[model samples]
Target: MENDFEGRPSSEEAAASLRDLGADRQALADGVQVPKMLLAALGGVAAWWVAGAAGANPGENYEPPTSGWLGLVAALVIAHLIRRETGIRFRKMGPRAALVMAAIPVLCLILFSISLGLGSFGARWAVLLTSLSAFGLVTWLAGIAFRSALDQLRR
Candidate 1:
């Protein structure tokens, strides 16, 4: 038996279809090659999702990042599965990307003031702020690195 789609194609072949990977049905109906609106909308949604997950939560959690860790992990797992099933291009994520991804959650967790930890509401708030700042810095660096990596791949 012959399968039309034999798993993921090589980088060259994948690159050719990258523009249409995340496209919407409207573009397909319109017989367009590119999906500008879909790409923009997805980008905006992705940014908002990341920021919300990374930002502070409303619950007075005894654990700082614990409340969001499960949600974040779940989202990541779901995304991975969806991408695989949908035949999206899966890029090579090196140590740098893994480190940055892990850092986001761990950095936030560092602010957690346990029983023997930084002892006080005020100090906890301070730690929270510091954690947010550090997370922002790492995220900024990650954005640059991610963009550069994509540019290289595209080129």
Candidate 2:
């Protein structure tokens, strides 16, 4: 006699079929999604930090609070865009990329400090312009680097 379950697939088999049809290997391996709230909160914190940095009066003449805010916003936007374009999580980008990304901000900070040392203009304005230009350049370079790295990884 034939068993009642002879024609029926096991639950595991059905689940495997659904997974094959609906999900990619990568999706199953490492789930990824836009971290919107985290990004927004990071932007807000950067804005607040820039405001405080601007207020510190580093003994220069070009005191512009908005400049600091703009630079901070630009960096945050760049980081957010990078995260969106790459499925690679920030933590998973490896120490090398993390080191490079970290260095970009530190270099910007160093430039700002040097600009302030020049003492030709308001410290705030000098720092803001220096930071914005440096960060912008670094962000552009980083986009290229990330694309290249992703290409290499795909192979």
Candidate 3:
């Protein structure tokens, strides 16, 4: 019975056969190159810097809010571009993966808003740093997740 079961092919094999597919590990890796990753990172950094600078300067209150929004937009765009270039569709993302990516920005925004509401002049620099750091952390985490997912897909 064990031998018969062994020879019959597992569920994974059955699924694989049903899909009529073969892995394109190398193609996937090639699609998402180092340069693209670097560009994404650079874009994230630029966004964070702009936000921090604007947030820190009281003279330009409008600047910080604008930059913060721009930064968030840029991060999402970069993430989508990375997904496209890597042949990783957003729809392909598992529920856990989607939650991780979505939570990052939402948490960061919440933190920033809470900090602003506290209202301490001396805390301006701290607020700026915190916000930028959150942005950077979230971006970095997303990048890592993307790469890891790609690696898995390659396998």
User: Highest lDDT, which number?
Assistant: 3
The TM-score leader among the candidates is 3
RMSD of each: 11.0, 9.1, 8.1
lDDT of each: 0.44, 0.52, 0.56
Across 1-155, the per-residue lDDT of candidate 2 in tens digits comes to 98565576789998987777555643523444444444444444443433345445554464645666666776567566656654554335445556665765566556555655644455565556554555455545454445434433333
Q: What are the models' TM-scores?
A: 0.37, 0.41, 0.54
Instruction: Name the runs in model 2 displaced over 4 angstroms.
Output: 1-57, 60-66, 83-91, 121-155
Error of 1 at 69 (Å): 3.9
Candidate 1 Cα errors over 4 Å, as ranges: 1-66, 73-88, 113-116, 119-122, 151-155
lDDT of 3 by residue, 30-87 (tens): 5666434544474355436434543443443533456666665776677666656655
- Put down candidate 1 lDDT per residue, 111-153, tens digits, no spaces: 3322114334323334444444544554464454344334333
- Relative to the true structure, candidate 3 reaches a TM of 0.54
Off by over 4 Å in 3: 1-64, 87-90, 117-121, 151-155
Clashing pairs in 3: none
The TM-score measured for candidate 2 stands at: 0.41
